[model samples]
Target: MLKHTGRRQQILVALVAFLVSALATVLASTVTTASPSVQPGSDGKSGSPGATSTKPSAPSSLSDPRKPLPIGLAYGDTLTWKNDQELAVGLGDAVDSGAKWIRVDLSWNDIQPDSPKTYEWQRFDRVLNGARARGLEVLATIGYTPKWARKAGCSTDDACPPADPAKFAAFARDAAKRYASQGVHMWEVWNEPNIPFWAPKPDPAGYTELLTATSKALRQADPQAYVLMGGLAAVGTDPSIAYVSQGDFLTAVCKLGGNKVVDAISYHPYTYPYLPSAKTSFGTAMEDISSAQGNLVSILAGNGTPDLPIWITETGAPTNGPGTATDGKTIPPDTTHVTEAYQAAIATDTVQAAAANPHVGAVFWFSDQDTGQAADKQHRSMFYGLRHFDGTPKPALAALKAAILAYEHSR
Candidate 1:
């Protein structure tokens, strides 16, 4: 998922220029696949020892009677690599756009590169502190195995799960204790574990173990913290590869008792090319997340927890990027790439659809801004941001803001 380019250097120059202009005016701000798994391992029956049996339950609404449904933005690794000033601007834009929450990765490998004994908090400190300064809540996604903690023979890949779940739990516990008071209360256990890229091979029992350990540790450190299962990548079944469908993965995890430890199930239902409401030809109606939500609910209920909520942690359509259009048009000339107008329309529709669903608690757009220069980046996925990489607003940004405001007002 890492791309090398001079884009960061370019962004740095743009930020510097913007900062100078703001100083003149006294300030300113700016902003996985799976296969028909050999099924997720179920330890025989539900509620069995080490298996989750507690019925899934939603957080009590009375707990925060006045809190509004959250609209968040996935800020990616920006905080981990960007400077303080860059972060401040990005966060400020999020606040301005009515984003109630911002998700950032808290990579274990980055924080404890050498050994568990040596922890580096400088980068995360700046991100948490910067977000707090902007009056924004943070959803810290904790994951990635350090080289020392990875299983034997595994490359130094962050996606590899640690050989010892307790070590991962210990890191999570430390993070929870360190950031509980910093206005970072929500924690997502990992990122797209359903995909092979995120996990060497998708294993229900293994992910469940990681989730259980991390959840328990975080709870012990901060009882009030909300722990969410990492968002599953939305894709259909394909037997040839080692990927599992989101539905099957959810079923296996629940059967293995994942529901007992998690507060909510998270997913990234990116329906690119097709609108969120469009039905996919792939037998399953997952292209429309609302349909997927129904499937998720049924799966959870059957596994024992029927009352859990779904958090759409990431989803978006890129307006312009390196990709062919569904209509078979080449993207760059404005003939093939998804039009800005279409992106805005779909964004608005997607948010509205999520808001209408009672099961959905939060909807976080894939990003607040696009990555790299739109013209130079080879990966179209990097263009999913609501704003262009250089900080210019896209129509989707306005659409998102409006959707958030409308949803809040209606509530």
Candidate 2:
């Protein structure tokens, strides 16, 4: 009887243990079934197959090619009585009227009054700081020699300078460093160095030397800023006296040690008494100036500097200057013939043409004021301004405003 009872108890205990083990296994399985494992997507880059993306999309505005046109105005004390106050006022007006940049003439003479010793920086600092305060970008052109620094043959009659490559380079380096500290960028080594008006004589070697020295020194001063070569005045009529036919000058420039020192080729493709149209106007055609610029582009493209751009530093028609100056040098009679309306029309055409050129990064009108020189009397003397000396709007001023409006609308 005792053996039978003991066996029965052991069997019952085993059954209970088996039932508990089965329940625990069922609970473990339920826990695992509640959680899911991550699966790879079709692309293998996403959470699951055909999963909706949560990544941010690119902004719509940045995806377009069209951008705001860079409009610049030529402002210098030589033309207008420019002081810090006047600069502020002019800059304010420029910003109001759609000018993105201000071309300031940093005459080598102005910054360095003497040779090799000291630099007069007060005026430059004033101009730079004033412009900055007013929110204006500067396209600074450094050229012209002071009476003391002029080479032996350089005439005091005008602003021309003899080629003293070393001295000029030193000035450039110092000026660039001083201004760079002020956050000023964008420099044009010398103004129209290929022309006799700016140079003592037409010598490509001399110009190249000046360019190389100044460029290297400028870069040393500020590696981040840009250095633009001065514009080649169009060889309008008499290509001989025009200071190394525009094309030849450009070719010479390119052949000289390549464009490692230069960034952009500055040009003055002036349209004196011409307007933009499908057909070439009387004195204007892309082909006319293409001889110079085309060769430059080709050379740059041939080299690896295909991305280099161009800037029309100065462009427009002068109603008064001699129509025969092939070098496109303007002998200002003190004013210009472009009436307010006429000037406005030309201004509009200029902006439009500049905008159309993909390689043209910027264009500055030749001048801002009539230069208050009443002694000289010619259309060049009387007209150049978008306003009169008293600050009244001219038709050309209106035209510029309209063009800017049109540009804004197109964008």
Candidate 3:
């Protein structure tokens, strides 16, 4: 998931960078391993409690009026910003791309940058309302501690955990309460907490505490919401650099009862240099999601949350780099970089693979459109859109749309 080396530079501009997204709310005090229960409000008309084993089949027409999509068919996009017009155009484009869901940041710093009591709801509200108007479901990733929320003289990246997690829980409750009625039920705690995104260092226990508090606070505000643990970035253990393998980080959290408190596990299983279908010796990417015996599914099962659902909150491949081959598109490379053709292949493989696996509740491609001529430091490449920066649609987007339509209707 660490596709860009300049991520630190990117973080300077993204006050609400990737939220580790540990989330929760009206979840039953004790969750069942196989299918977690959601409140009636969360399910909308379905009014079902637990997640359905088989997702509702997709409508015949991709562009037809999209009913609330089933989780299994929950194809989505991770968006960086939600300006007024972009929602209508960008999100509208998402729908055209066969995406029914959007995972967007609800930065705590942006909302309450002034003080604990001060709040600004106008901009965030536009996202919720806009998505609702377009019938696109939203998963709000809430995190990013404000300057005041961090300890004094704390000069770490915005990934710093709040000095008072309780304060963040309050902000989460307020945000959840304010948007629940406006049609936002999915909440992710933070983004990639298992990496440098957690700041000073990645602390599963600290993140667990924050998720627990935020989950409890959300329960009070909106009993109908479904909370997800922050999306764990796929990485190996490297204490020398303050990194913990996703397996170790999650195992530690599950030991602390993190698995028992939430409805589903959020993960970012980004398979780039290799396509999702590639058989690699290295145990990373899609293998972390399902292929390997030690993937998220088995990990949660062994740790006590057996058959728990996994929402692939972020996954995609970069379209350009030194790795690019002639003919303008490269195949998978030896490094984590891949060409547009291969990236398009990933877009197809990811959707088809998720459809074949029931444990995957959702898969949101890392972007909706491109931001740079090619992914680089300035654009925060990780969240680049599926299209070219020039506004020309990439093969990845079309591939994703066709794959979704095929998977959904076939079901």
- Top candidate on TM-score is 1
Ranking according to TM-score, highest score first: 1, 3, 2
lDDT of 3: 0.69
Clash pairs for candidate 1: 30-89, 31-90, 34-243, 34-244, 35-243, 35-244, 52-257, 56-305
Once fitted onto the true fold, the runs of candidate 2 whose alpha carbons sit more than 4 angstroms away are 1-67, 77-81, 155-163, 237-242, 276-278, 281-296, 299-305, 319-336, 372-382
lDDT of each: 0.73, 0.61, 0.69
- Residue 187 lDDT in model 1? 84
Regions of model 3 farther than 4 Å from truth: 1-83, 325-336, 374-383
lDDT of 3 by residue, 105-197 (tens): 888877887788788787677766776787777888898888888855664556789988999999999998899788676788998899878
lDDT of 2: 0.61
Clashes of each: 8, 11, 21
Flag the better candidate by TM-score, 1 or 3. Answer: 1
Native-structure RMSD, model 1: 21.7
- What are the per-residue Cα lDDT tens digits for candidate 2 across 230-338? 7777663354664665656766766674254565667777664445422342335333433333555566666555555667777654433333222223323433343
- Ranked by lDDT, the better of candidates 1 and 2 is 1
Best by lDDT: 1
Better of 1 and 3 by lDDT: 1
